[model samples]
Target: MKLQESTMHQNELINLNEYLLTKGFELSEEEIAKLVHVQKEICKNLKWIELDESKLYKIILPYTLSPYLSFDNKMITLENAILIYYKIRSMFDWHLDDETCITTCFKTYTSLYGIQDKELIKTIIIGLKKEGYNNNANDFNESF
Candidate 1:
């Protein structure tokens, strides 16, 4: 018997998102791309929020819900971005970093904040992760 292998392209498996939107209920390829761009922005913002906590407060403030949050710089580590997404939207508190002392923290930002306009935010977060983010779910899962 011979073993054969087939290849699937990276961007092949996709299910249409009914929640995806434009001015109305429609998402063109360009619109989809735009959504992806928004996700990257959200990821960047999450990272900035974390940096603000780690650097400014000198204490790891519990993550928060930030709908309008954004990172002005394009230098946030992919790891941090993913953590922000998972924590804020999923309410998942896991470690996505090594230097952080504690883990499994609760959200710092208000819950309502994240729930407001959450779909757009979630889309962006998932997009960023797809773009290559390595987050440690344990970061948010650490409690003690």
Candidate 2:
């Protein structure tokens, strides 16, 4: 679903939470509200032309999973994760290039978050690459 510049309604926020649940994120109501607010703020600040449900999910996915992500025995806090996610989103808005944005996100995470686990970083990069390829393929198919 597309979300314009208007404020999200209660039912729409509930639907967004339900959608996140289907994607394996069981966020609380408060968390869902925060995510919606964050998305709106980002779009407003960046002057994004469009804000879709899929884009919101992609933007907040890392932040949602941040609590479970650890590197070198150090846990990534939600606050830090949110910052990283925002940076990545902003980069995407500026560049409109997935590879560059993803790479910059990885680098920023490693440097600022002190992620010292090389193997973990490698796995994350591989996953991002695979996802990128799949998204490209899907975009190609949908364009036809």
Pick the TM-score winner: 2
Question: Could you tell me which 10 consecutive residues in candidate 2 have the lowest summed lDDT?
Answer: 135-144
Mark the 10 consecutive residues where model 1 has the least summed lDDT. 4-13
lDDT of 1: 0.32
What stretches of model 2 exceed 4 Å from their correct place? 1-26, 63-96, 99-103, 114-144
Could you tell me the lDDT of residue 50 within candidate 1?
34
Write model 2 residue lDDT over 27-83, tens digit each, in one string: 566765575576566567657644345454444344333333433221223333333
lDDT of each: 0.32, 0.44
Instruction: Report the lDDT tens digits of candidate 1 across residue range 38-139.
Output: 445655755633322122111112221123233331113222434443344433223333223212222212333422233433444344355454433433
lDDT of 1 at 43: 50
Give the distance in Å from residue 44's predicted Cα in candidate 1 to where it truly belongs.
Answer: 1.2
Instruction: State model 2's lDDT.
Output: 0.44
